[model samples]
Target: MKDFSDFFRNPHVWDREIVAVGGDLSSERLLYAYKNGIFPWSDQPILWYCLDPRGIFDLSKLHISKRVKRKINQKRYTITIDRAFEQVMRCCSHRPDEETWITELFIKGYTEFHKLGYAHSIEVWDEDGKLGGGVYGVAIGNFFAGESMFSFTPDFGKIGLFHLFEILKKDQFTLFDTQQLNIVTLGLGAYQISKKEYLRRLESAVGTGKKWTPPRVVF
Candidate 1:
């Protein structure tokens, strides 16, 4: 395993070009880089970032609507963590006719992270155990970097998120970094801050060292 810190020591990966040397994506590498507040987003071959403010959700401050709450209470689906990670990522890849940085390389990397116990996923499965929707990302210390999510059914994505929130908040997470904010996320209680401000909060969150333990399985 390559030392991920080395990738950003030069910080060349964040340069955001389609260069050839960006190499492969793996969990060991992301786990190392995530601890340092860096992620690889590539359109083709090279990785780069927009270097703007980041959008985040304070786990302690999650705002769940009565509507979403009722939906969750209905228990229309079964939710679990770290199950069907690749499937969730693949579904998220084909979102709303949008082209994303998520690619074969992205799946390969996060999958590797999943195996390494650094990356985790939240899964929403129907009664038949077929995948409904889910989200995946890297968790280093107390900060969870929410990579992406998707839903084939209405509110599936939001339910998956709310379930994840219950676990993270119960475990005392300091923050949930959503990377970037979108209209959907704004409705889910996400807010934006400058990258510098993000780093400051990141520092505070990481230092707190929160531990998350999922709920006991009903089965």
Candidate 2:
């Protein structure tokens, strides 16, 4: 197995978008990938994407609309962490408007990652105890790389995201990686930077040695 460092140390594959196709989703490989800013995307031939101009959330600039602020202040939903990771992944995989890329193989890989404490989920529950929405991702050092998110009700995903920011903030995490930019993420103040800049920040973040455990407060 060619390690990630080998890819970077080499000249040819260093400039490529798809890092390695046949690498196993073992804990070692997955952790190595995240540490180097690479992540598997659910595509044919199993590509690992590390796009230039990576999308990221600036903690100080995260936007919360008045309506969302009202919803959060109303406290109609409860927030929990890592209590329902598989359930959250399933929810994120089955959306109505799009064909989900979260394949069975992807789930199996990430499930193992979760059991190893390298991945996590933030879930929101309605007042009636129903699953409202959630987000999940992998964490390394002071950095978090969000993989996917889904909402079962209006604004529930946003609620989950809000609490996630709170957790990250309280934990002194340095980076909140969104992987890619979208209308929703851009609206929430996520911005793009060149892959070079991202790597520089990522290097600093991974050296922080921050643990991936969930924060203490859960509501």
Candidate 3:
């Protein structure tokens, strides 16, 4: 991997959300981009963005509603890590109303990252042993970037997120980057931090050498 680290240091890079464009989604490039507070937002041309007011879930501040808690206690679905990574990505991309960026190229790239143990998924399985919903992302040391999530059952996606939060908290993860805020994430207690602060945290978090381990069944 070439040292494109200096690319981010250019003064003009901070003036916009998209600092660069046109790059292959190779594991090395992806790792480098993410480590520097950047992520690929689309394909064809492959837009890379580093947004200001970055969104994140501070595990300590996560808010789980009583209704959601009740659902978790019911244990209607079983949760596992990295059990169906690519399947989860496919589901995330299949949203009927929204345009998706998880194209085949991005899927192939992240899948390779999964094979190398940097990318992972949390799956929610129904009683019939089918994927009900899930979330997937990339992790380096203690830093985790939640790429996307999807659900086929009511609140199953949020259930997967709650479980993911539990694991991150338990495993001592330092950063949980959601990239941008949306209604779903905001309801889950996600908040924004300045880009400068985010990069500062990312620097420390990415080198903490914290490994992500599968959570033991808590239900």
Candidate 4:
């Protein structure tokens, strides 16, 4: 990892790696980064990015196991959209081990985006009507820029993800952006690709002239 100091002072550009600048970031800055194919990751203030190849899950290319399918069919939770987006963001921020930059400003900014019909959320509620798992992010046309997720129980992530997948599949979404690579998501079939390729797909999807029409209620 490069020092946060030199990064912002002089942004570096490499063939395989993308540019990374260092500095403070607000929610507005974060959204601007996403739209520009850059994101922030630092305890201090550094912007790091992997240029080559982006990670994505094409709706037509998703690989859901039969067991997971059965479990999803079980229908143990009530899935809702955007009704509790802020709650979903809080839940994702609550997970331990990582220092989250999801500040109060982020919550307010994303909430405003939700009101404008760009951001979305999938919330899973158990039989008792308590929140179990959730996922939230920005959706530009048919492409979903998934930010974070949280689960109160094992496999709740699967439930929340599958629920979102079902809707995207039906709606013919072009891509699902998981942002970065991790064992958990890799196991779920998310893989990495170059930023150029990611940008291409992103442009195509976002430029398709489709409007985001969130479900009246959770699907």
Candidate 5:
């Protein structure tokens, strides 16, 4: 793996969102990038970004609508963590509308990260014992960077997000970086913060050395 430990030393990269380009998605590189609030957004040359307005979930203010709450109460789907990780990524990649950034390289890289215990997935299974949907991301210390989520059934992905929030809050995680905001995330109470504020929070969150342990099965 290339040594990107000093990749941010040039100060100039700080002002631009696309800080660097052209690097292999080695596990080491991914860890370093995420720890510093940078993430790869595109392939080909591999565009890495540290957006000025970073999207994040305010854990304390996560909104669970009554409808979603009722769905949770029904217990129609089973929730488990760090299960079906690669499958979750593949599901996220197969979006029907827009193009997806989850390339083959991303799958290979994040899967290796998952194997190393640095990445995780929250899976939702239907009553028939099939994958309905799930979310996946990387975790360093108390900070979790959610990469993507997908759903095959209505509100299935949201159920996974709710469970993920519970796990993070239970573990006393300090940061939940979503990277970009979408209507789904916005409805779930995601908001944007300046990069300056985000980096400050990221530094504190990463240095806390907190461990994330999955909760007991949620039915």
Candidate 6:
């Protein structure tokens, strides 16, 4: 594998809030990007972004709604980590909200990342043993950079995230990098920090050398 250091633009210079707009999504390249707080979003020409005012989850402050709490306690879904990574990504791309950036090429690239133990997924299965919802992202050190999430049933995505954080907390992970903020994430307790501060945290988080481990089964 060749080094991709030369392919990346300086993330510090986000004249238009875009880190880089064109590059092949190779395993090496994607890994490099994540390590430096850069990620590719679904867009024409495949834009890479490191957004200012980055949205991140502070596990200690996560807000679990009464309904979500009920759903979790009821065992409406079974949570499994890293069991259906590719399936999770596929489902995320097919989400109905908007067109997705998870193209076939992106899938192939991240699949390689999974093989090398750098990417992971959190899967939510209904009682019928079907995939109801899930989330997928790349993991480096203690940082889990969320790529996307989707739900087939209401709040299934939240259920997946709730359990995922449990595992992350138990494993002593530090940062759950959510990239950009939205209503769903905001309601779930995500807060924003300046990109400068984010980069500082990312530097420390990516150096923890914490290996991603599969979560204990949620029955």
Write the residue-wise lDDT of candidate 5 on 1-219 in tens digits: 345956543222468888888877888888878878888987898988888799999878888889879998999878988778899999999978889999998899889988888889999999998999899998889899998988898888888988888888888788999988988889889999999899989998988434456654665
- TM-score for each candidate, following the candidate numbering: 0.83, 0.92, 0.93, 0.79, 0.93, 0.92
Which portions of model 1 show Cα errors greater than 4 Å? 1-6, 9-23, 208-219
Q: What is the lDDT of residue 172 in candidate 1?
A: 71
Question: Candidate 6 on 1-219: residue-level lDDT in tens?
Answer: 355656667766654567777877777787788888889886468788888889999977889899889998999678888888899989988957677779998898898889888899989999899999998988888888888889998889888888888887887778889998899889889999988889888898889444587754665
Give residue 107's lDDT in candidate 3 (0 to 100): 94
Mark the 10 consecutive residues where model 5 has the least summed lDDT: 5-14
Per-candidate local distance difference test: 0.71, 0.83, 0.85, 0.70, 0.85, 0.83
TM-score between model 6 and native: 0.92
Model 2, which residues run further than 4 Å from truth?
Answer: 1-13, 208-210
- Candidate 4, residue 145: the lDDT equals 80
Q: Count the backbone clashes (under 3 Å) in each candidate.
A: 4, 0, 0, 9, 0, 1
Error of 3 at 56 (Å): 0.8
Which residue pairs in model 3 clash with each other?
Answer: none
Better of 4 and 5 by TM-score: 5
Between candidates 2 and 5, the TM-score winner: 5
TM-score of 1: 0.83
lDDT of 4 by residue, 106-210 (tens): 667677867766788888888898888888987766778887888886566678888788788777777788877777788788988777688777777776434
TM-score of candidate 3 relative to the true fold: 0.93
Candidate 3 residue spans exceeding 4 A from truth: 6-13, 208-211, 215-219
lDDT of 1 by residue, 90-121 (tens): 88898567778888878887788777666778
